[model samples]
Target: MSTKRDIIEQLEKNYLFAVIRGKSFQDAFEIAKASYEGGIKNIEVTFTTPNADKTIEKLSEYFGDTDMVIGAGTVIDDITARIAILAGANFIVSPNFSPSVSEICNRYTIPYLPGCGTVTEIANAMATGVEIAKIFPGGILGAGFIKDVHGPIPNIELMPSGGVNLENMDTWVNNGAWAVGIGSALTKDITSDDYTSVTTIAQKFSDKLKEIRSNN
Candidate 1:
């Protein structure tokens, strides 16, 4: 099997990973489909979401035929990461850097993207052999922050999450983000009665991303 870093490399090559965090597994699944239709081939279902493990299983089965990869987010420990991985998570994302969690992913060959905000934290995550690191609360840190970090650690693959949206996605990508993790911005209200609207929003976001990349 390929290593976790290999899986993450493939995901970065693909360009996007839809992040879903909500109160309902069914709703998260619906939103995930909308993202898939929007051209996103990767999705992350945060553990904070209700029935998160089941959500991963259902999404794994639902997208079994496609190249789409489903992962578990907000993983804080090795046990939760193991459970989620066993439940069919192709990748694992943590809100904070945890060497133990990274160790587990390395053992299972599952991709791991751990969260970090400061240079020390980023360095710590990288020291554990995790290549992709999530810059949480993007709105607070901003694209400039990412650019600043890249000045010193140009080799680290950085992804911005939290408060990422259509308005700022281009800036984030332009500023050296390997990819971005979108939550409420992309999944909010996607499970409403208006499925078409949900799909439309998803497509719009995806289209915008393509447009930005094309111009770049």
Candidate 2:
């Protein structure tokens, strides 16, 4: 198995991971490209959409040669993980901690970000031999909560998702969040009428992240 640092390094290569959850695969593809062009090299396509496997396969085929790292989100169990992996997902993300899902990802040598909201859950995820955990509902927990949690488990890599925007991105990063998972804030304004809007938003967010990194 690859070391946790190895996975962290891989994730760090692409600071932004776009979360795409909607009804249209075509729209998702366009949104993905917009993000990719705007400097985000990672994308997470959720499984709740229709023909998600097909969407993953299409994205894998389309961006196979690029440096972009495409992954699957909302992965629940081992079966979904296997399907996503087969469809060419580079990683798996879940909304809640699932050892079975992590084990499958580990078996396949793929990185998994298991969702954890509490100290016990974070410890449990680390106990499974997976060091990266996603702090879900980041809006509710806030950056202060993350800082408090890391006081004891500084070794744990916590990626906060949900309610993350350009405004508070730096706060999370500065407060011990290894990375952040951003959704609607980055894609909501993007409509089929104009694709440039998507790329513009992505670039703005990327620029903000860079500014934050520099200041920190």
Candidate 3:
């Protein structure tokens, strides 16, 4: 099994997490597969989807030997966190911080990335051993928030989720985002059964990140 640090490094190297929400298990699986094919090494399947646990299980088994990382998102409590881990989630994420969820993730040695909107929340999360704090509603916070937060807390790793897209991805990286999470931008107008657009969009994102990293 990969260590927590190993997974963290992988996340940083990839610099993008495909946030997937599907109406069904097959929908989730296919989207994830398409994302992987498009060079997305990290994927976060939100619990909002039906049979999310089963989807995580299948993803873990399918990508068992690859460097791809599968995570559970929208995880709000310890019970859901534990369930996701048991179902083979490599990490856990939530829209807001939860102490119980943090404790369970720490106990299991899985990386926990909880949404934090303020310096106090980020500091509180880091105090509980969180390595990366997700800046949800990134569009609202904007890339400037990362820079602003780094001024007071220089070492905090911030990954922006929600509203992150190829157009503004460079700005986020330029402002020192640890990583980024993309959702509907990757699927957009594509129908449930046709994920070709997903692959196309994911590739663009992958390429954009690479270009940004190279320039930096």
Query: Each model's TM-score, in the order given?
Result: 0.93, 0.93, 0.97
Backbone clash count, each prediction separately: 0, 0, 0
The full ranking of all candidates by lDDT, starting with the best, is: 3, 1, 2
The root-mean-square deviation over C-alpha atoms between each candidate and the true structure, in angstroms, is 1.7, 2.0, 1.0
Give lDDT per model, in order.
Answer: 0.83, 0.83, 0.92
Question: Tens digits of per-residue lDDT for model 1 on 141-201?
Answer: 8888888998999988888888777887889989988888877767455444455555676
Q: Show where candidate 2 strays beyond 4 Å.
A: 1-7
Model 1 regions more than 4 Å off: 1-6, 190-192
Query: After superposition on all CA atoms, how large is the RMSD of candidate 3?
Result: 1.0
- Pick out the ten consecutive residues of candidate 3 with the lowest summed lDDT: 186-195
Best by TM-score: 3
User: lDDT, candidate 1, residue 102?
Assistant: 94
Measured by TM-score, how close is model 2 to the native structure?
0.93
Best-performing candidate as measured by lDDT: 3
